[model samples]
Target: MSNQTFKFKQFEVNQDQCAMKIGTDGVLLGAWASIEKQPFAILDIGSGTGVLSLMLAQRSSAEVLDALEIDAMAYEQCVDNFEGSPWGDRLFCYHADLAEFTEEIDDQYDLIVCNPPFYSEDYKTENTQRDLARFQEAMPFEHLIESVSKLLMKDGVFCTIIPFKEEDQFIALASALNLKVDKRTRVRGTINSEIKRSLLEMSFCEPARSDDKNVINTTELIIETTRHNYTEDYINLTKDFYVKM
Candidate 1:
């Protein structure tokens, strides 16, 4: 629960050096992103503490797990966290923004995931690091999708978590680049609350199990029945990582 470090069931994440600490959005994306393809390689974009890559390392036998972080401190912290983890050899972190990483890394990944910054371009605070980590200008949806289209293998999966309001626009952007949504989950803090975030899984084509018309398998997730009272679906989704779940 502390910003300094978060203790997971299988691994520990030291987040003190990062501008952004561990949060529910990151956890949901990390746990919900499908590895059904049995991805041979995985990439985590904007990996704040490299938690998503670490989680995937624990869940999959993937030989390569790479993470990218733009901030120097966060990148160093991410590397430290990965090195201290059980999958040290399988994990590595790069210190560079998405654009630089996208341009330099020629290899494609079977699975690519991101929890992108969504704040409006008009918004700003004096805190530069936090601004870079939370502003949309830093990693616009279009640029993100375009990079993903190039970095993803032919049959690869691209997954991300974004604000519910941006879901339609985000999907549209990905669609332009030939990335189709194969799976989607709308998330809320509680059953009574409005949808807060969208978990999206996209690929080059529609899922083989369904027709092209059925672009996505949609679902809803309510995190808690009430404060500290977790929902079964939520718990099941995160039980593998959350110690209390």
Candidate 2:
């Protein structure tokens, strides 16, 4: 709950130097993202403190788990976190911007995950680090999709979490790049609250040429029934990581 550190069942993420602390969005994506085939290689963009990559390392037997972090402080923290984990040998961090990494790296990953900055509001924060971590301008959706297309294997899955309102536009943009949503989950804070986030799994595989255009699998997840009252679905999905769960 604090910015200092987040202790998970299998790993501890120290975010004291990172602008974005561990939160529900990252946990949800880490736990909910489908790793059906047990990918051989995985990549986490904007890795922050490398929580997502750590979670994937705990969940799957992936041989390689690489992370990319642009911020110097966050990149250093991410490397420290990865090195301290049990899967340290299999985990690695690249301290470079997405554009540079994409341009220089030729190896493709079986899975790519990103919890990108989706806030497009016209506002400025005194903290430049927080602004860079929270603003969409730092990494636009188009650039993210383009990089994913190039860095992901042909059948690789791209999982991400974004504002629920951006779902349509995001899907459309990805579709333009031949990425189709294979699965999607609309996330709400409570049963009565409006959807706040969307967890999406997209790939290059196209839907069957059938009459039904809505081939994407869709579902909904309610995190809580009331204040601090976690839902069974949420607990079931994240019980492996969260201490309280």
Candidate 3:
């Protein structure tokens, strides 16, 4: 296991030497994933170092939680993290792609979460391993929709985060797969910056109230402000995991 610990409000994630390390995107998705009323079972696609899975385990009362990772190294790391966590018995990691796992797996989950690779055409690094983890060619938007459509239970919900620029196209693809946008959050880096990411939760049926936006400025707006200091709202939202706010 990696020696790095991702301290959260109630838990700490030890992620080191994993192909996909813990990042702001995963943290936001983990903290933002809707677990209202609690879910009986949950799934995390592209589980990476299992940060989202760990976060869900800490926040919800789900009895069964599973994570699927296509990368061999990441799958192993996820398994290790799960085994070391308090919810070890209830959490499991599958070393297979989503499409392949869905074909043989029969169980359905109430909630599913994913922080998928969104850089479809972005320039990739020379490292093939890192490219596989960061690039989108491994799992395109279309493929994600199809896989989620097949894996999610009739009453289940699928949640994910993507680049804000892809919002319109993502919604269209989800619609084609029979999934409706249940909730949408447009996130901005700062008050002055343009929207950069969109956190989406989709269901089989349309939500009565769905669209919402949140402006999260993680860093200090003024030069006198110290780094790592967060706003009140940001602190409140992620206080559970970050050791220092």
lDDT preference between candidates 1 and 3, better one: 1
Candidate with better lDDT, 1 vs 2: 2
Off by over 4 Å in 3: 1-3, 206-227
| Candidate that would win on lDDT | 2
Please, what is the TM-score per model? 0.95, 0.97, 0.87
Q: What is the lDDT, from 0 to 100, of the residue 65 in candidate 1? A: 93
lDDT (Cα, tens digit) per residue for candidate 2, span 1-245: 58867899988999999999999999999999889978999999999999999999999999999999999999999999999999999999999999999999999999999999888999989999989999999999999999999999998999999999999999999989999998999999998899999999999955657665757799999999889999999999999999988
Compute the lDDT for candidate 3: 0.79
Ranking of all candidate structures by their TM-score, best first = 2, 1, 3
Q: Point out where model 2 deviates above 4 Å.
A: 207-214
Better of 1 and 3 by TM-score: 1
Give the alpha carbon lDDT tens digit for every residue of 38-134 in model 1: 9999999999988899999999999999999889989999999998998999998888878888888889999999999898869689989989899
Q: On a 0 to 1 TM-score scale, where does candidate 3 land against the true structure? A: 0.87
Worst 10 residues of 1 by lDDT: 206-215
